[model samples]
Target: MLCVLSLAPFSSPSQSRSRSRSQSRSPFLPNVRCLFGNGKQLQEKRRRHSKADAISTQEVLDLFDQLSTAQNPPPSIYQFNQLFAALVRTRTATDNPVFSLFSRLIQAEGISPNDYTYKIMMDCCARTNQVGLLFGFLGRFLKEGCKTNVVVFSSILKSLCWENRIDEAAIIVLDKMPKMGYAPNVVSYNILIDALCRKGEIEKAMDFLHDMMSKGQEPDVVTYNILIRGLCHNGEIEKAMDYLHDMMSKGREPDVVTYNTLINGLCKNGQIDKAVDCLHDMISKGFEPNIVTYNTLTDGLCKNGEIEIAMDFLHNMVSKGHKPDVVTYNTLIGGLCKKGEIEKAVDFLHDMMSKGREPDVVTYNTLIDGLCKKGEIEKAVDFLHDMTSKGRKPDVVTYSTLIDGLCKKGETEKAVGFLDDMMFNGHKPDVVTYSTLIDGLCKKGETEKAVDFLRIMLGKGLTPNLVTYNSVIHGLSKLGHWKEAFNVFRELVERGFLADDYSYGAFLGSLCKQGQSKVVNKLLDLMIKRGLKPSIFSHTS
Candidate 1:
């Protein structure tokens, strides 16, 4: 989560009361303490403890217990607020425990929940995705006559939006909030707009934007950024750019986030050069591109087969005092591997380690996959050992890549050994692993063994996907098992998989080879009825 800058520190009940009293005092004695008795001391204590380092949830509970047993009969709200803040910062599960703590605070300590208390509870609801609990809390808040400020309402709207309950959020923003004497602010508008855009309802999002403008609410940088990102996500880059122009015309300068969104969209849409132009434009606009900006451009260039240019951008990033992170190195390594530059990719890996940027599992997986595809299976196997020895465990992808390479090299028995090794290492073979091995066995004229593996996959409760079924059908057809092939094809259709051209061709060819002309004609008619066109290969067979 990105941290927003705030002029005031986190407010507690005591601090708020002190602030209210201070506001009425004369300007000449700004530091004069209007707070009396224990309240002033409690506020000072909270100020001192609030700046403490993050503490665990258990520590928070312990502190609460200590305060409860203290010479003071009831603990200050500021102390509870500090504990709550610490609990939130520690990323502890704050739902039930927080509710229990609040119950104790209200029932036993007789402490009234303040605005900051409600805000913290709402935040907990949002972070834990307990929007249902938010409604319960709101009812209690209203019953207690707690003011529903914009911040609290925004938190509720944000939680609803996060859960994709945009309709409920919209009702709150458009109707319920106004009825409660709270107008939807720019933050509330942005939350709903972002949600709508994420759900691909760009038109509805635009309607809300226009409605906001009509109500005399100026769209801020966040509002424009959300719309641009949504437009880019929906592949409407041209429209996104138009919105960018509109944003600038409305006197809202595009920020780095705006340009980064455009750059990512352009790259995904295969407009790398245009993305580069956007980067340059951002630099000229006095926006120092952050790591995200540089990483986005590097990935775009790498994906477009512009590896050399991507590397140059990396150098530029370093010269500009931006250290390349793991993501930056991974993108470049993946590009190098894709271009069959395995050696160069390895060199980059070493460079990354020398620079104190350790290669992760993704880094090793990319290089291993590249080596396997390049038919250097031995080197790939060695690299897998090196990865494990360096405390980087090989995932399914790493093992699967090596198994596939071994199978493709006609080393089916060796691939089977690796499969056992994979299982021993606590990695279960997925559909891809089984399909690869099945195909390799069939290609080696071991259809019986392939069928056995198929049964084993089913026994393991793995549903065979399209690729798996297609490979089996092709294998059985090649081995002159037309009846078995036809049965598998029928099962494929029954399972809701569309029989593609390869499927039809395989069955048609097998029937044609067996002189089953009647069966072939019926199959052809069925293919046409299913809206699958039999290719020339099917007819020629």
Candidate 2:
């Protein structure tokens, strides 16, 4: 028999002890009285039921052994089956201690992992971010003389691209593919195109798309989906819609994902009416709206300040047997935060927690950002402390948002302290983080400190962007350090870093402001020689 304990609340520890003493005085079987007190009977019933339902780990092992030791394996005993069995045993078995059972099977039973088996392993590795293992698996597959097919490689290609292993993925696609009896298919091209688009190289993706069509492979629904999603993500909404229309012209029915992606893009870009119309179109096309469809619509509605409509959609989702997951909650919280409804968002957070769902980092960050926006920095900091107390580590966004808030409040030193704390927390600052800090410093007449941060960024192998240089140049020029600023401008040009109109104008205006007419004319001549046309303002000034 398992012993269970449930302590009841009392006024004080002494009072609880006295109550226990009084209970013991009245009962002949004091332990029994304690066991059956209050809701203990129901707890005991559950305990008994749990014991009855328990299955031993040894029993599960024995059953698997029986299946493995069959006289003849199933006819469909593909290598994929072997790898899949290994994955299942490794990932799912709570009681199974030995995961190397498959290794023993291969050695004793002579069953080897097949091509499909290797593909599944590769795909699994990709999904789990064990992408480094994929190359070794691929090498093993080639050594085994197993042919690689589209079904086998597409998923691997996708995994590589998803993990930002684009260059390595490209080598396999472009150079090694033909030798391995594999040709670029629509899926292959789509993966590359999708990766390019993700990195904001839309022109490169489009060029590759054109090359793909020229190579005699017909683009399919998956191809269109990848392109459409990429275009929409890059804010080319008009072009993305054109692609959607193109899908119809090609007699391809748009899948639920296709509609949801476009609708989400529309909603994110604040085209709520268009998003609503897209929803109607999805319904009119006889395509059933899934949870994603509802959630996207709800998020869009919330973003558009249609909270009532969004809540109604949430209700509709449950009515149709669909339940919102963590993503749904996150999106709603984020939308509400964006609209300055943090109090309502906090209520939703409490509601979610009561329902046994935990708020993730995004949820906390959203609430924290909203609080900071309302100038409730102390409350925001309290929420952050609460997050840490709950054992949730703060990510870059958490630190970045707080730093930005601090900078906005003229708390530069505090912001720097937070930045230092972020480094201590093992989170490297991004470009945006640096930009914000630099801008803040420049505003507070801490130009030298800002330049120092910029140098440190570059020293850490982070690229100094146009914004970094522009900030430094502007700050130096404002301090009447014309020579130093001009030196930077010359270095930027010499390094082939493209300066925007503002940077160009600032540099030219500084020269003109200093009454260095000769140097200004010389700089204009040099600019024209470099094929950069002087703006009318620059020329006149």
Q: How does candidate 2 fare on TM-score?
A: 0.61
Query: What tens digits encode model 1's per-residue C-alpha lDDT throughout 276-318?
Result: 9999999999999899988999999998999999999998999
- The residue pairs in collision within model 2 are 79-114, 80-117
Instruction: State the lDDT of candidate 2 residue by residue for 1-541, as single tens digits.
Output: 1112112332332333444445424311223223223355525533443441242333323323433444444223342253243343334332232223333334434456677666765565555555455566667677788777876577677778878888877777777676777788887888898898889888878887888888787778887888788888889999999999988997977898899989989988999889889988988999889988888888888778788788888888888788777777877787788888888888888887887778888888988999888777888888899889878889999998998888788788988999999999899999888888887887677878888898888778887778878887777777767887888787777768977766766677777778988988887776777677889867443
Q: In terms of TM-score, which candidate is strongest?
A: 1
TM-score of each: 0.87, 0.61
Error of 1 at 425 (Å): 1.9
- Where does candidate 1 stray beyond 4 Å? 1-54, 72-74, 89-97, 539-541
Clash number for candidate 2: 2
- Clash count for each candidate, listed in order shown: 0, 2
